[model samples]
Target: MEDTTQLLPILAVHFHNDLGLATANTLAGIYVGVRQVDVTINGIGERAGNASLEEIVMAIKCRGEEVLGGVYTGINTKHIFTTSNMISKIRKSTKNITDGILKNKGTYEFVSAEDVGFIRASEHGIRLGKLSGRHALKIKILELGYNFEEKQLEDLFWRFKSMAGRKKNITDDDLRALILDETIVPQIA
Candidate 1:
């Protein structure tokens, strides 16, 4: 509660998707002197969810590399995705707590039935994909994804880009084919 500047020299911003609070929180933390902060992947909360850890991390990189007077943390940035997955499992809601926190944690029924396949790892939910033409492709290659190296991102950009009048964005069917080609086919083919 005592978010005085001295208390937080670095901000671990838990950016929830409400009222643009995540960026605001990180900015506030930075203003208040926070240098490190807590975060999650897609802002998965017990109900309305929290902030996105990936965003704050990238924002730091953007400012550091471009605007923030040459200051970038040499973090193993590739692990950001894995870290997000882990936290989602850790801070996820139980099968109970349907009513509300404090007021409903004890009174409500189990709304989120894990037995029904509502997994703690929320892969079933609406997710981001490199489907917005090359825009998403570049974001995945340069900023997001599992095995993207910064140097390789440029090459990926060119490789995935459209030629002449073609668009090189990923599609739902394209993703399905990739899944079948890489994951499913490998298992059975």
Candidate 2:
């Protein structure tokens, strides 16, 4: 990597998240002296998407001084959340075909699940499965109204993975149960 950088002098890194390693690899590039990176907000791109701008920016912001020897980008860290949300809404608008189905009953043939006395299983309607990443799991944890320290989150993540291996879809109930199990202390008489 260093030899190639020496030869090119202006080498850049661009990666896709098909294997969930794009962000990690991009950071590796920075470590190896690559000064330029091609990134997209929320990792939004073809297929699984490219390296996430938010993730890369936050990682550098949080750990660049200690880990990357003070390397940093010009990204405004505060606007990351808003930008991520905006990009998500844009993507959903393009891909979500069920947007009008809920508003107009006559749009689709199937009966409205809500009208049949059915309610959403989770407030955010998000389910974690095997391929889910740590960022997504953390967001879901926050959405579920629980906060864990880094170590606790690491432990919880492994537990979630174990359950996800067996369960096709991990619902809010399942996550709440896991949280309770981790937090509750048993009294020995």
lDDT of each: 0.46, 0.74
Q: Model 2 Cα displacement at 99 (Å)? A: 26
> Candidate 2, residues 1-189: lDDT per residue as tens digits?
356645766769999999999999999999887889999987888988899887788788777889887899977666665666677787773222123332343565143333223344444334578866666677688888999998888889999999999999898889899888888899999
Model 2 C-alpha lDDT versus the unseen true structure: 0.74
Cα lDDT tens digits, model 1, 1-189, are 875867643434555656758665764665555656666566565556566555555666556555444555566556664565566567673222122322332244232223223333122221223323443444333232334455554454444443212544354454344333433434455
Query: What TM-score does candidate 1 reach?
Result: 0.35
Q: Per-prediction TM-score, please?
A: 0.35, 0.46
Query: Would you list the clashing residue pairs of candidate 2?
Result: none
Error of 1 at 20 (Å): 3.1
Task: Tally clashes: model 1.
Answer: 18
